[model samples]
Target: EAAAPRQSVVRRVAASSELVQNVAELAGIFSCLEEAFMVYSTRKAIAIDELMEGSRVSSVVEDVFYVLRKCARRAVATGDSDCACSVVNHVCAVLSQRLYVELEMRVGQIGRNKERTLDLTREAQYEGLMEALAEQWPMVEGSDDAVNTSSASALGASAMDLSTVSLGSAGPGGVDHSVLGDGSGGMSSTISAEAAFWCLSVNNVEAAADNVATVKATLEEEVRLVFDDELESAKLASCIAELDTVRNDFKKRLQTGMTKLCASLSPRLRSALGVMDGASAIVKYELTEAEFADNDGFNPFVHEFLGALERILAPHAAVLSPALFRTMVFKVAGYLAKQIK
Candidate 1:
């Protein structure tokens, strides 16, 4: 008797070039998923706190699942049962199990304030994604439904009927596949749709978070430089220049509807508004020759300058008003003078 065809191996003698290409595409899809995971891990390592604000975890979860859905669609198209089974198992395990765990860990770390913001952002993104997916996976209603009886059924069973599966009819909560091995196997639409929603949401939230960080950092840099003894002569000119530039940018953002981002820069705004009028007066505040000489000397070398400076400046950095900054300068000058004596 003739031996039955091997279900696990793709026979070169029997498989067409197009079928082979589809199998190769499945491998490529896995590579893409692995690479994306690597990128997500690296970014998380750099700053889990900040990235969580950006919705990095949710974004990666969505991206990996979406790609897996596409992989399943293409795998079924190849008409190779073994390849399709492998595709389904591999994609599902990576996206739903492994990727899900990694994402959960980061999501657990998000602060309550950021978590609320992320929830709102996700809802908006989900609606937009639902509309977009609607166009991609149009479903047709009919009385006849096509079914598969492949051995690949060992994989997760999807409610979606493989034979009748269209991109649109696949819906959002189940798996839809073109074909599978001798048993039965398929992709889950629910996971895929959920992932797509979160991925888009993360992109949106991350952009907004980054904008806030950027504005806060820029303002802090200028505010700190205001007290740099090196820049005493140019203090007024520099403070006005920097604050004016920031104000223009702030006004522009206000015009463009970035009120929330503007609000986030409250510390910067308070300092700028209070300092613009007082910087010149403080700069011109006359220092007595005795006051300067009383201090050990100008710019005396201190071995523990950084540590000591941080100890002195930590509290002040938080509430650095013009008067406060001036106080810090005189205090620091006196401390430095005492260090030598």
Candidate 2:
């Protein structure tokens, strides 16, 4: 009876030791995976040349998920739910911390661009106004200091006058909205590059969502194959729910990014439409029959507005996916209809 009690104690010690060893092994696996994922993410972050070269989505979207699948399968093969759960949770952490943050930052850049674009537009308009003024009033022959004083006073007066003038107004001294349409004005390569990166960020979110679903399905299948017990599979299904949350988060970000992009285009669209308003105001419906006959039925404002819109949207259409492009078009159309109403 004493020997039986001693044997029981020995068995208990062996069980405890095995549990500790298993936990240590699992910890090692988790550490290795975490380190590997961090390295991969860092490498991809540094290698942004592909994004600059017009890759629609970051390669990390595919690469990280690819690694996740392999790691999840390996964890499942161990037949330990703790190991599998730890690894899956780590995957979610990596995605939330790394990929999601990167995407959010990229979308944030769009907001900054909106302000920068407006500032550039204002600067260009100021420059155009100064040029127009210099042409309209030639500088008088005088001392350099006198000329400077005269120029500064004229600019200050013009700036004050411009502050009250409507953007749509046009006359001999009025600001020319047409300048905004021409390539020589405010549009720059930097703006185009920012737009391209925004498109890529949006595409990356979409691609990442799809990849997450794919990886989840693959991991689930592997889990089922590895674990014969229904209860164990149920536990894994619960674990996989974490991935579903990540995918949903990605979808939400995608929608947010698209909405922001559409909103950003609104000011430009309104400016284009403003040209039509200005033209309509100056239309002379009481033209003589002979003058009407010579009108040639051309609406210069409509043509100008459309040309400006095409210039504004051409880069977006070229970069965005067809589906996304269609969504943007529909949204723009709805916005126009609302404005018309």
Candidate 3:
């Protein structure tokens, strides 16, 4: 008798080819997640505390889930065997289960003013918020055109059904076949709708997270070594001094990064705003897992996010030098370790 196919194994086999496009794509996604997490962790080394801004922090959280969701949708839709491989790359998933515990300590440091954050959290959200959102972002594409100020008349602000997407006969730039193993899996969607590109990062890439762990551990060790064993007491204080300077600098640049990210959204902000309306209900979120599973909209955000990040980084990279940006990873981890320790 022909052996019954193992869905897990079949899925794994299917995902392998899609991953062959460019290995860096996978790593880059993980690295972005790791960088976000490390920024959460190391407040001491590079001083990424400004990433604590509530809206900014929320955006980062949204970004993490978005990429993961995108990865998952492609994995399931295509039945890629390497699905779990992508899941494993998520540092957010791998962190200790009590991970939420860390949020308790950092909440105050990472958000907008308390009264404003509280006011924004009222049970009933306003329709004006939607209008504000629509006014900002009508439609966005990867190609850098001026941010569209037009509004979409797309009916209600309700949660959308994603399965309706059509992968018709190919049109220019609308769809392109990505390299994958054993061929036979290229369904293309019209480029007009909201979707992220499946470039080198998410499609055929594998990222490793252990390197980040090593970076964290080493920074901690170096910091600890400077002050004897009393991590708190140990302050040749030059490290602390540098960290303070770094944090201030990182904060300034992060604000700049956030502004760029925000400005870039002028074209896609409405979609994201619509996303915000449904976000609470659809994915009320679970302590155990994200609220909603990967729907079709998820896969495309990968492309959208890359476009957003590029715009955000472009304006701010000059304000923050490459060395500091690289060190931000270590500094964020350092700060977090200090906070919890």
Q: What is the lDDT of residue 64 in candidate 2?
A: 65
Clashes per candidate, residues 3 or more apart or on different chains:
22, 0, 30
Could you tell which candidate, 1 or 2, scores higher by lDDT?
2
List TM-score per model, in order: 0.21, 0.62, 0.20
lDDT of 2 at 50: 35
lDDT of 3 by residue, 1-341 (tens): 24446766775676586655454465456445544554344322212111222111212233333343444233323322233233323333332222222222222222121232334322112122222222332321322221222223111112223222232322323332221111222322111111111110111011112222332344334444433434232332222233233224324434443333223223332332232235422232333334133433343333332222222222222222333333332343343345325
How well does model 1 score by local distance difference test?
0.34
Name the runs in model 3 displaced over 4 angstroms. 1-220, 223-235, 268-341
What's model 1's TM-score?
0.21
Minimum summed lDDT over a 10-residue window in model 1 is located at: 140-149
Number of the top candidate by lDDT? 2
lDDT of each: 0.34, 0.58, 0.29
Worst-scoring 10-residue span by lDDT in model 3: 197-206
lDDT of candidate 3 at residue 319, scale 0 to 100: 22
Clashes of 3: 30
Better of 2 and 3 by lDDT: 2
